[model samples]
Target: MTRIFPRPLTAAFAATAALSLAACAYNETLGRNQFLIVDDAALTQQSDAAWAEALRTQPTSRDAAANERVRRVGGRIVQAAGLTNRSWDYAVFVSNSPNAFVLPSGKIGVTTGLLGLVRNDDQLAAVLGHEVGHVVARHAAERYSTTALSSVAISGVQSVAGDYAKAAGAIGGLGAQLGVLLPFSRNHELEADRLGVDYMQRAGYRPSESIALWRIMAGQRQGSTPEFASTHPSDASRIAALEQYIASQGWS
Candidate 1:
């Protein structure tokens, strides 16, 4: 009879022990207990790299006046968002995708396609406020941290199994699981919407413009989904959440 070995069991236990210690170490460094594992500096570096690559491939707006308008509104929103510690760089992309994003390192991009959707400075401020809220709340960092934790968990599993093929298959399965996390992404969108209204109001822009902006977006989405839907709240859901937030806060 073949002798049975405890290598896999021992390795599994060891991996679990290491992960526990790592969690403790991460908490110490963050100065608080956090459910997500993350390295802020590493996430910032990754964000910067991704942003740089995007800028290189994407076309930027050449219309000087339009660019200026976006910058002006974006500047006010950034300031009002109180993210002075972050190095903010705002740009107008020449895409017709009607989308916008705020990167982890405070890089803001607004597509020219969204210009027509914004009726005035206040409406534009509403959009900018929403984008800036993502940066302020460190949503990107949270997402990255979740991804890192998953990678760590996979690594631990692989160490115990000692089967590279199995590990690869497991990773593919996990990737699919992560892909289904779109609702979590949507939750981030709602949080940003609530914070955006408050930021716009504090900046002296009528928070009501946010509702109007969403109306315009909803109208545009009647034919098909907006590009913003990939990373934003649905129009009706966003408008309702914003209204609820405004009502709760008693902000006029």
Candidate 2:
């Protein structure tokens, strides 16, 4: 039996496949290939919207000192990353969780708890550098491209099925979050960590303090998800890797 795809559907599939193939490009900075179907303009627009939504929905800190500190440190990291071409904006969220994130659109959010946790400027630079590394490495675009390609592939499967099912059903809520709106893969995290230390050291910050910051975070007895289950490396493994990378670079 011969099954024929509709002309429009066949065209769509061809386009999708072409996009997938064309998206694989080598990133010189990351020393790897990245799947980036979406262009920077689209990602930046989405990031801008996401940053605005975060600011409107989340409780942000009004502390002058905290805001200034994040901005000051973030500025140095961005410069070190050679990403000063974009206008970077910083915001401190009023959260107890020690967390921070950077959008590709040059928006950074740091929690108040993170500000309080860091013992010095170097440690703060470490955190900011990690976030900046994500932007530099273009992890968000890669994740979005991978998820979009998966969704397209699943849609092709649906076209052949007797009854169409939502792609969301094929990929559950958790999978969707992981593919779209969550932390990066463990590999991405490690790459970010390495790039972060590079930027930190280049910016005249102590590369070793980055490891210390992670140690302090590991010691915090907080009820949270484990690293094994999350898209982040274990604290121990992360520290070890950072130490090795620092030693290889001879940055002390």
Candidate 3:
């Protein structure tokens, strides 16, 4: 039996395959190979939209001091991360649950609850550093690229045949949900935690405070999802990792 693919589809597949191969680039910063098919422009646009939507739908804090504090601290972290290329924006969302998020577009959203939770500037720096680390590490971009590539491959295969039911492309990629708020992989969280401490240390903040912040978070989430089942790493595991990394760097 002979199977034939349309010439256009064949050409498309060949071109995409070549592009994918070319996109497998080594990021010295991350010390890993990344498959990046989507360009930055698309990511920036999506991120901007997400930021805007969040602001529109959510209630923002009218507290000027809170906004200033986030901007002041976030600026230091950004500078320390050597990501001063773009203008960064900060917003204070009025919520009781302590939370913060960063967008690749350099926009940051922090709940007023988070501001109240931080005991000192160093603790605040730790949180900002972690978010900034995610940006510098390009974790969101990497995740998006992985999901996009998986989807393309799956769609391409599905377009082909009924005979190839055995072709399993389902790796459970998050389809089209490109929000910045999505929880990163456990490895991503750990890497971000490491990078967060690095930035805060360089920014003249105490790196040990990073561990302290995680401890506080752990205390607050006393009985949440189990570590194995959660998207983010367990707070204890994260604190231990941060402690080890900070000690290894000889930074408090």
Candidate 4:
């Protein structure tokens, strides 16, 4: 019934409360409570499948040395994060675009472009540590939960607003982005940056190189999206935050 659907933001807040206690978990590492309907096991399973698909479809390099280098640096990072419970796999993908990613399944994929871009192992560790932080922080699960709840909220808005439903739904969606989704994404990146430096320091890598790595990435990206609309923080913002954090930790 039309009457059954509550106002968009109202439904979102109401559901968020009910989803608490069970769904809202406090992460001591992050020092925040997260709304997570999904678990790490589920994320790992999904990532494992995606890793398989990527390996099958992507042009993976047979370069033995490159693969070993990734394994070496990644192994240290995993150890530093105390996430050595799972077996970690590393692969080099033949791509010119400087990029890297880590799956929740402890699988890491690095582009040859990224390998060529890094000036040293410390820089590589900085990059890899950031990806590992995403895994350790369970950012994927939190993002999934937020998206699922936001969709339900938008649908409620559409069902209840009648003639104005489309407009109401748009407003609700935008509200979710500005108030919840985008902020969470940007915070996640910043958190990962901080965590990455922590791991780099623990792994005996120079924490300063993380800043250097990000600066190079900034040079590669000409004009960036504004911080408010963008998911990731701008390079300048990220660098400034990292500098502040590294200094607070008394790391050069």
Candidate 5:
């Protein structure tokens, strides 16, 4: 039976290859191929549900100005990204962390701290543009596909290990961590940065403010987990990349 179970590993690889054959598609905007097992329809449905859950559970800001600012800036970025066909919702969460996120379903949530951090509309546009870029790049679907592949690979290993898999709590834990908690690659971050500035510029937001925003973000950073272990590029690296990209565009 152990021998038989080991054969499932081979079957698993075959399954992965089969999955990849149909899932690999070229994204012209990103200028690359993405491995995506989930289609937009399904992804949007899932994201809508998640967005609803977040709005329901999270403490949201009622500050009219903050809410209006995010919506106003976000609208321009989404339009620039050519993603305005969908109904987009923006909310400000009452949190100290200066962060924002965009759902695949065209929902955006920003922290009040982020509102307080930006010096002007252009800087806020920079952050919103980056989040919009992630959506236009179809990063959420790509991330889901990668996580699914990780699970498939982990299952394959467990099959080969047979009874030993039951004894490997550490391996199981690592699999969960890799499957869920791992951040997007630095390449993804850089790509998003470039795409963001493109949208910012197209929307008539000063491209140079994007650089300034990152510099401000870098200065505000006190400490973070090492870059190797983080899902984001180091602040210095991200800022430098943004600077290089903005210069390449000749945007002052």
Candidate 6:
């Protein structure tokens, strides 16, 4: 007996093969030519929408003094970093996660947990500056571009594979590709640390406070590790890098 697959299937497979090759070629060329793909506008739009959704869903603190402190520090860093032209906003959330993040649109969020860990305003500035560094350097968009490329590649592979299950499995294999993206993240973190220190110094905050701040953070994770560990550089590694950057900048 003989079996025949539909012509549509064959055409789809051909299309998939072409797309996969195109994606590979684009990635190779773009990777060599540029480090980032998406522009600032698109990043800002996506980030703004996400930030708005997060703020809407999460209950935030209304403490006048606490909010003032966040705004004060955030404002200083923004000005020092020459981000005055950017649409920036800062908020302190009432969470105990010891975390902070800055959106591509300059929306900044710092958890109450992080505030408790910080000893002074300067330390807070250091943290905020680092988060802002991620934004200024457009790391998130870079990640997004890579992710889009991967999605396209996977779609192409699925088209050729013809078996949805096999396609899903192939897509699942993207963890390694994602892991390869980490070096870029690490580089961004180091750059942020350097930029944060510079911003703090210019804002009249002692850059040395960053060292103390990270030390305190490292000490705080005595028993359990936080979820951010997966995405963020390890505490020891980050602190060491920050120290080296500080020393190089002659911050002492």
**What C-alpha lDDT values do all the predictions have?**
0.73, 0.85, 0.81, 0.90, 0.84, 0.75
Q: Where does candidate 3 stray beyond 4 Å?
A: 1-20, 156-184
Q: Candidate 1 on 107-195: residue-level lDDT in tens?
A: 88889988866889898888889898877666676666555555555555565565574966577455634453455577778877877
Q: Among these predicted structures, which one has the highest TM-score?
A: 4
Extract clashing residue pairs from model 1.
none
Output the number of the lDDT-best candidate. 4
TM-score of candidate 5 versus the correct structure, residues matched by position: 0.90
The reply for model 6, stretches above 4 Å from the true place, is 1-34, 162-172, 175-178, 222-229
- Positional deviation of residue 105's Cα in model 6 after best superposition, in angstroms: 1.3
Q: Which stretches of candidate 1 lie over 4 Å from their true place?
A: 1-34, 154-180, 222-232
Query: What tens digits encode model 5's per-residue C-alpha lDDT throughout 1-252?
Result: 354445687888789889888899999999999999997667888888998999899999989988988888888898899987899999999999999998888889999999899999999998999888888888888888877876787777777675798555457657556444454566677788889899989999998898889888888988887876777888889888888888887887
Q: How much lDDT does candidate 4 score? A: 0.90
After superposing candidate 4, which stretches have Cα over 4 Å from the reference?
A: 1-13
For model 6, how does the per-residue alpha-carbon lDDT over 1-252 read when each residue is reduced to its tens digit? 887655655665566556445543223312332334467688777888989988998878898888899999999999988889977888878898898988888899988889888989999999988887776666677677666655554554555455575856455445535454555566667778877888899999999889899889878775644424355577788888888878888875
TM-score of each: 0.75, 0.84, 0.82, 0.92, 0.90, 0.78
Give lDDT for model 5.
0.84
Total backbone collisions for each predicted model: 0, 0, 0, 0, 0, 0
Weakest ten-residue segment in model 2 by summed lDDT: 160-169
Candidate 2's TM-score: 0.84
Clash count (model 6, backbone only): 0
Better of 5 and 6 by TM-score: 5
Q: Which runs in model 2 stand beyond 4 Å of their true positions?
A: 1-17, 161-184, 221-228
